[model samples]
Target: MKVLPIFLLLFYMALDGLHAKELPSNGNDEVIFPITELQIYADERGFVNFSDVLNGEVEFVISEDFQPKDYSVDSYYWIRFPLHLNNIESKQWLIEFYDQTIDVIEAYIPTLDGSYKKITMGDHYPFYQKSFDHKNFEIQIDPKLHGEIVYYFRVKSHTYADIRIAVRSINRFIEYSLFEYFLYGLFYGMIFIIILYNLLMFIAIREVKYLYYTFYIFSVGLYATCVDGIAYQYLWPNSPQWNQIAHGVFLFSLIFWAMVFGHRFLNVKNSAPRLHKAIWAVIFARVLLFIYAIVFDNSLFEYRNIEILPLSLIFYTGVYVLVRGYRPARFFVMAYGLLFLGFLIKALLNISVIPFSIVSYYSLHICFLMEMLFLSYALSDRVRILKSNRDRAMQRIILQHKENVKLKDKVNRELERLVDKRTTEIQEKNIMLEEANQKLNQQTAEISKINSILDLDNWKLKNNIKEILQDRLINKNLTLEEFNKIFPDEVSCFRFLDRLKWENGYSCSKCANTKYNDGQQKYSRRCTRCGYDESVTSNTVFHKIKFPIEKAFYILYLTNNRQNKYTLDELSEMLSLRRNTVWNFKKKIEQAFSDKEDSHLIITDLFSYHINKKVS
Candidate 1:
């Protein structure tokens, strides 16, 4: 696909050459001159007609009437020759002239005789003369010369041989010119695209290499254009002053781009830092040469020659890289090789050491075109390689991400299991705590019931004591000791008196004394010697007692043991006492206990009977 265009271009070059020719028009008459030999004759009279050259060294005579004119003067003369023929024929030929003084001059074959009949020279007429013999011809010269003149003429054979050669030459020139123009357009277009594309790449990637490559490509393109002569022909034809400078600039840029593009393309540092530095040194030398050219335009030729040395170095470096298996270096070597060969050929041809022709002019451009195509392909290959690697890397990244997700899921599952186990353990502990709380609540309820029973027993025991004290009148002279012996297994007699005293100590029952008897014996025979037959129990709890002390103590013991008021009532029934009497006894004892509670002193004295009994 790529080679097709090159083939077509070559085909056009060939065809253009084959078909090219210069045709004669109606106003131009072709001339043909025939001569056996050219000879020079001289005579004493200076009148010479030395037309025959085979007569042997004839010192031909010259007419004294002729005056020699200096043909060295800058002037022009119109000359014509007639061809006598039987039938009208058009002839085309190229006239060749050799002269050391051929200045700006124009010549054309005249198609008509007497075309300028009125035009005269100094003494003769300017007109073509017809020949007497039909096969013979006459040559006419206008503005006749007065001195010796030398001129040789021949007709460029328009025959097949000559035509073929001329057509080939002319066509080759045109084809080359057109091809060069095309190459200029192509390379310039490529340079523009490269610059724009790489500039955008630099912006997008922010890679310094892209910027360097952009500058390098631009420089290379400019240098290539200039070296190819396309810059002169198309870009700056009228600017002759820039010609030398353009050459220097082209060489400088070529070396610069060579170094930069090579360094970037080959990964110079990793591949060959020493070679890279050498290449840069060569480039720097080329830069110096360029500067010298700028500073001394007159010595431009010398500086240009100096530049070629660095260019040679660069070429060798490229060759080394390419041989070392640098992939891009292959293209670089190929392109630079073609360019260098083209330049060498052009230089040889331009110096006239070789004939300058169309093939020579365009061969360089074709090579350049080939170079550009190869370089572009190389760059495209680089892009493809980069894209492929990127895709692979992206795939790897995606796979890694998927693996990471799987690992994360496994971790989450493990964490969830741990959380569930912890929750279950906490729930079990809460249940155990609830059971323990329920047991504690039952224990608390039983303790409350036991306390209530103990309270009831205490109340019954206090009531029994009150009943025994209330029977004082009926049980006169009944000593507490005797009372205790009657209820032997019950409260002691001293305890009964202590209970009665606690109830009636503040109120004298016989005397109705409200003052407490602090010194009175608990079982005194008479209340403070009253001697009125009043017993210590007179007007006290014992005065009103109906139940026997022994039975009452038994009931108290039973009630205190059972700790139930109902048990006390049953016992009373067994003793054959009225329920009302037992009940009244219970009420009076409770009341007496209540009164004792109010009258008892919370004494701090250690010798108090209350304090001593509490300790016992």
Candidate 2:
């Protein structure tokens, strides 16, 4: 029975050795397992264990594709490669995985004791727990392999991971990593310098376009680091899960700021108006996509090719504006053009359309560098063109000033010549005017005596007419037109009240102060001692009347006149006031007269002067 088990083991080893490749002896030797050399199997149920794989229960299929891939995120991919490692005596060897973004990796190596040893490593764990302090996944093979052995690596990720395993001697791995990090330094250094320069430009120029460009390039750098695992190793060494989502975060920022910067720099709102509205729509859509990726499904972040849409739109906007005769858009077009090509090459690589290489892998970084330089040049070129236009305008103004100065000099000379001729003509006219002036002076003395006599007669005539008009205001038979002749408006009525109420002297209504300054009103007085203001109508029967002062003055004049025969309706029609308004005012005046204690004095005249004796 033991012989039967040894015979079965030998038979299985013979079958596996047929597919095994020889492990190199030199530590400098490097080898890559292509799709033809490796066998792939997906654990769709994720329940297949190492015992099933070792017992030859699971079937593995060889892929004809250029690179092996974990196509579905819902399953685990088990990749097995048979290697003749019986000759690993000369130097050390390690398995290196190129894709650092894989969430989990389990390497199962066959031991000389005829059992499989398992090792688990991935970005899901902290960086401090990593076997090798490097960006890529590396597993060191022990020198205990007896004969041909099959190595199995179970790859699982939330996103599609490119499965490329390179078997390198320690010497080659060291050389390759040093050169890669060196190139990364140069790449990031240039980006840093460009970002710093653009940031300074934004600060100095105070333009929003420069600010947007600065943030766009910064996002590019951060995303590149996240893609290659440099950020996991150095940025957040403790948090490996962040390595998964950093790319999506930075890429969202990258395209977002790029669209914004392009909009302003291209002057797209004015240049391509219809397309201008479309850019914002695309931005809105991109934002919605990013939100969905974060909140619901982070796997959507792996759809990096979606960025091509916005970048293409930006490129088209640059072209459209440039074709419309916008000269500053030249560098802008070149910048986005290279960027679009980089994304194109990357998208092609994702599908195995382009061969994977160091140059091909970092193509986006190179294009980002080129695009950064061109965009800075674009901003500077715009400023240069604007300065040229301003300089030309200044030159035109200077030339116009010179022309105006010559025209003004010519006008001054013509005016001087005209003035000389006019001066001589006026001198001759002065002599004739002086001789005529003597005769006019004698005639003026005779006219002056007659003018003085006429002015004195005119002054007396105006006074006699004014006295008669004022005197007729006391007549009861006067009509509305006749009453207006003495008090035509509120000003005339207030003036009469001012003169009649303060006929003897001025007095404050509240404090009865004899001294006062000018009040706020025209015919009102303010007391100097108590500061009380006595208006022209304050103490009179006309105070606070609802109708106009002249109308109230007319009503009072008619009421005081004993001969007045006009009824309330007739007075209302003549004064154009309501009957009740006219009647109410008449009663108010009568009440003032009835309130006076002096029965001997005329009612209207005595009532006004009763309290303060102001109208006496």
Q: Which candidate is the best by TM-score?
A: 2
Writing each residue's lDDT as its tens digit, candidate 1 over 1-616 gives 0112344334433433432222323443332221111121322232322222111233322223322121112222222212222123223222322110121222222222211222111101111222111111122332222111222122221110000011112233345447756756776897788779878988997867677767766776766665554564456655545653565676666557756775677677777779778877776776675677678653454233344555566567777766787666777677767767766775565444555355875666666566656665666666777798899999999999999999999999999999999999989999999999999998999999999999999888766665544333123333335434444642354455545554534445567545443344444444343333333445444454776655554443332222333544674566688888776766655565476763222211111332224323
Off by over 4 Å in 2: 1-12, 24-28, 66-70, 86-89, 143-147, 351-359, 418-616
Residue 399 C-alpha lDDT in model 2 = 96
* lDDT of the candidates, in the order given: 0.48, 0.81
Best candidate per lDDT, number? 2
- Per-residue lDDT value at 338 in model 1: 75
Candidate 1 local distance difference test against the native: 0.48
135: Cα error in model 2, Å = 1.3
Query: How much does candidate 1 score in TM-score?
Result: 0.39
Q: TM-scores of the models, in the given order?
A: 0.39, 0.68
